[model samples]
Target: MGNCGSSASSEIHDIDYGHERVVYYEEADEVQKVGSVYSQPGSKGLNQDAGILYQGYGEENGAFCGVFDGHGKNGHIVSKLVRNRLPSLLLNQRNTLAKAITGERADGDLFQSKQVIKWKEACTSSFKLVDKEIKLLDNLDCSCSGTTAVAVVKQGDGLLIANLGDSRAVLGATTEDGIMAVQLTTDFKPELPCKLLLLYIQFLFVA
Candidate 1:
């Protein structure tokens, strides 16, 4: 982990996990940006990928990060589109929810009690919307192409994650035996969880 100061209102952080670059965030006044990208590509072809999102996510203390693995013929296109759009979509959903729930409530109250749940809902709706947008694109052919996504949003000491497809997230912790890796999220795949498979089936039907 390393940190560098950009300005009074903003700073950048990088967290390294082995050779893979795991997560990064920038904080500037009311703007926060989160992202992660693998430093190296797969054994096959060139690295066609993306990382992170737009600004104005949350307060200065919060951040959002995501990873995308593109596969198949038009996989690169799909991944890039989602990476570029998901952040705005998520913030939009979160803000809309905030308005609905903040009618007669204090902002700090909502931040203290319901922030994580709010972020979870926002992430879910954003992912679903982005998926639809991908399919609706007139130029892209995603018949056999798709991308795996895993995202995390951090507010103060709280964390919220949303994932789809087969991407995974892990945490490195200090143990008695030195550093240990703990799996934080599952690799959503066809031969894996029954729930994911069912969700995949539902998605297929919906598509």
Candidate 2:
């Protein structure tokens, strides 16, 4: 649960979460930012959940948001760790890609092409790196426990979404009659037909 806005004060706002720092940028030339977040635990006790909502991601006018749901004994810890780390990892990867592409001469047709490709690459790299780091944590035992992540990034009018596990997202739009809901992702659990087929084949081989 959080809210953020970009101000023209030239000061960087930060809040510490354990050893990690969550940052909010406020600069005179920065883009306008406004958003709020809220969360409530379900009926189950001992909640193990985490989430993020950032109004200015990498560039001005960009946004990033995600939800993490943890399962198993140490699920709470894993969820918090991811919530703290993933955003920074994503921004860093994007910035690195931007720097590498700046030196290359762009063909008019390839200008937007590279930017799109790089953003996708950044998302991929950040996810992999974070997963590896999680596995390497000495104190947390994730052998039978893990977390599901679903994220969305907004760059001006365009959006990029990524998901792992069963979490879902939807877009709401105003229609002639009223507001309508549009689903943006499919459920990625093993119950899906393709995954069920793969699991069945694996069981046969093991038998």
Candidate 3:
């Protein structure tokens, strides 16, 4: 990995992923201005937003990280959900992705194809469970709490991200558009038509 100082935050951080460097413009608001990814404090949904990033290179295990954005309250729920579970889950499932991609699945094998599908399914199911658990929380300090979540688990040249809400995943691509970047996740606007599908895709795409 590598690091650099920015024209933005005073905090010095070196971001080196051992791959071709990807540039990000990084959008920040007065509040999201904390200059951190997914640091948006949860205001509506579970009072918290959490995310995880796992970089699985060729190593037996991958580099893993998760962030929780707390809303309507402190970062408690987001913190617990990520610190207590997200990391372990990412680690446990990453190898399956690796095997699926690098092993027999490269051929026309439908059986091994299940690995990728399983990964997607697992991530989707996990998000639902997370949402349910957050809703079940009865904290007096956070009765109306809700949280947005994003998680990543990487395997080989493939990366998987799961998300809910506006927290986003953008890809840095070298294109004719001059260091172009695109949002991989759809914004889940609650006021839109088919809000639920958007939300599902939001969670699925880790937006």
Q: Which candidate's lDDT is highest?
A: 2
lDDT of 1 by residue, 69-116 (tens): 787898867776777677668888988886756654557765555655
Assess every candidate by TM-score.
0.72, 0.76, 0.55
The collision pairs in model 2 are none
User: Per-residue lDDT tens digits of candidate 2, residues 1-207?
Assistant: 333333344454444333222344433555577654445566676667676666656674677777778889988778778877888898899889888777665574475567767777887889889989999989879888878777888775567777777767677778898988977766667767564212010000000
Worst 10 residues of 2 by lDDT: 198-207
Per-candidate Cα lDDT values, in order, are 0.61, 0.67, 0.46
Give residue 172's lDDT in candidate 2 (0 to 100).
Answer: 74
Best to worst by lDDT, what's the order? Answer: 2, 1, 3
- Give the runs in model 3 whose Cα sits over 4 Å from its true position: 1-52, 56-67, 74-76, 90-112, 132-142, 176-178, 196-207
* Prediction-by-prediction clash tally: 1, 0, 24
Superposed by TM-score, candidate 3 places the C-alpha of residue 75 at a distance from the truth, in angstroms, of: 5.3
